[model samples]
Target: MRTNKQVYRSGPAATKFAQAVKVGDALYVSGQVGMDESGHIPADLAAQMQLAYVNLEQVLAQFDASMAHIVDEVFFVTDMQDFMSDAAAIYAARQAVYGAEPAVCHSLLGVSALALPALKIEIKCVACVAHESESHRAKASR
Candidate 1:
């Protein structure tokens, strides 16, 4: 079997990892952190979580995909205690981006540390998209 591989870079100063990769119909997004184009990493858990999703959005858009195209996601949080206490608002902000689309499969994990100590959360997702005209978002809504 043959597979096509593609890579995405957030910046010229980016790390040695592709933000997102497209192989056939699956788009594998790397763990997006709270940082943005301006090197901003929010200290607040909710803000960090929101920014992480935003980062995910930027990477996904490169492949003509959006959060709506996401089928599954795994979130790595540095502090489970803090996240569990403020889960509601964080989830709400995340939903604001995904909108009213059907729920995407999700998992929350507690980790000792992330790429940065200031980084509270990192999000990664797998999006199954169409090879042709229709996309994952268009197909899932039907």
Candidate 2:
């Protein structure tokens, strides 16, 4: 049986779209941008990238998942020149959350623009729901 799940983040910055939809063990997170709970985008690329990941992390938390559970990521950027540094920032952010898991699959795309004028990066992720063992839930709670 398929279970339809919905996560609503109570914030003006969050999207009305379901942050993730789960079918059995698989979870699909929506595209996340570099905006905070108040819908303000950061001024610089590095800050924006950090914000984007933060938003993703919040959504993942709702599913009892972390960046460690993420199997795939799609990174959209406004410019290729910003790629390397921006990628490094993302890596750093991931490391902070996931602690060097080799489970990441990624695709980077250079796009003309994103939805918001101040947004320079958008990230989408796919994660698998961890089995809800007592220990797993404990870890997720941490």
Q: Model 2, 58: alpha-carbon shift in Å?
A: 0.8
Which candidate achieves the best lDDT against the true structure? 1
Against the reference, the lDDT scores of all candidates come to: 0.78, 0.74
Error of 1 at 128 (Å): 1.4
TM-score of 2: 0.77
Candidate 1, residue 25: the lDDT equals 80
lDDT of residue 7 for candidate 1? 57
Task: Say which candidate scores most in TM-score.
Answer: 1
The 10-residue segment with the lowest total lDDT in model 1 = 132-141
TM for every model, in the order presented, reads 0.85, 0.77
Clashing pairs in 1: none
Q: Provide the lDDT at 39 for model 2.
A: 70
Off by over 4 Å in 2: 1-16, 85-90, 132-142
